[model samples]
Target: MAEIISDLRQDDVEDTVPGGIAADRLRSIIERIEKLEEERKARGDDISQVFAEAKGAGFDVKAIKQLLRIRKQTTEEVEQLENLVDLYRHALGM
Candidate 1:
């Protein structure tokens, strides 16, 4: 991977893009990318962060973005649960 990246960097230097980047400059760019990759890896996630969130939330992501869609809780159920919570909180004079 490092060799391929170095080759690409050499090609990029030869095929200069506007500003002239020195070899050290290119190495710095590669190093920054590598550091970002390492940080991302330490967090145990891919470059995209949605997977990390899903993992943290204990989600099964086989369904893809289907999980990102919010499922509306039944209004009746929500009210009932809220009432139960209120009752519980008040029972202890909270």
Candidate 2:
């Protein structure tokens, strides 16, 4: 499986949202994020760093990480179900 980088960490030039964030505020956020990433990486991707940074930012670390995990979907092992669905609905005339 390939490791993924969050969209927030990407370097795309286009603004994904329409009439999006003001340049100055966006830049500030990016700079802070860079510092956060540096702090995270310095600790070798220790998740505790995420909590620590969130804490320093005056945000709830535990809740934020929990929210980040709420919508994750793993598509890695769905091949068998997909094949079965196709086999019944298409191939087998059910």
Candidate 3:
């Protein structure tokens, strides 16, 4: 998919938006997105570092990661997930 996109020709490029936005506006939007993507990569690295440190401190990193994931969900969502897990476990005779 990426290879196909990278192979796009100059003639294949067209301003599809109504009124055809300015090139400068398009360039600015792309630059902003690139910047945010770089920041996101950095944040992901930082998160990995934190997880490594937790493991080094003799913490159960896997359980801690699960707790962090569950904390991000709403109460109703967590209940639903738990219910699904219980149902699946029971079905498998676990």
Taking all chains together, each candidate's TM-score versus the true structure is 0.30, 0.27, 0.65
Q: What is the lDDT of candidate 3?
A: 0.81
Off by over 4 Å in 2: 1-45, 74-94
On lDDT, the leading prediction is 3
| RMSD per model, one decimal | 14.9, 16.9, 8.2
The lDDT per prediction is 0.67, 0.64, 0.81
Encode model 2's per-residue lDDT on 53-92: one tens digit a residue.
8899999876887567644535543555567788889876
Worst 10 residues of 3 by lDDT: 15-24
Candidates 2 and 3 compared by lDDT, better number: 3
Error of 1 at 6 (Å): 18
- Candidate 1 residue lDDT tens string, 30-77: 899999999979776552577767767887675544434323556686
Model 3, position 93: C-alpha lDDT score: 100
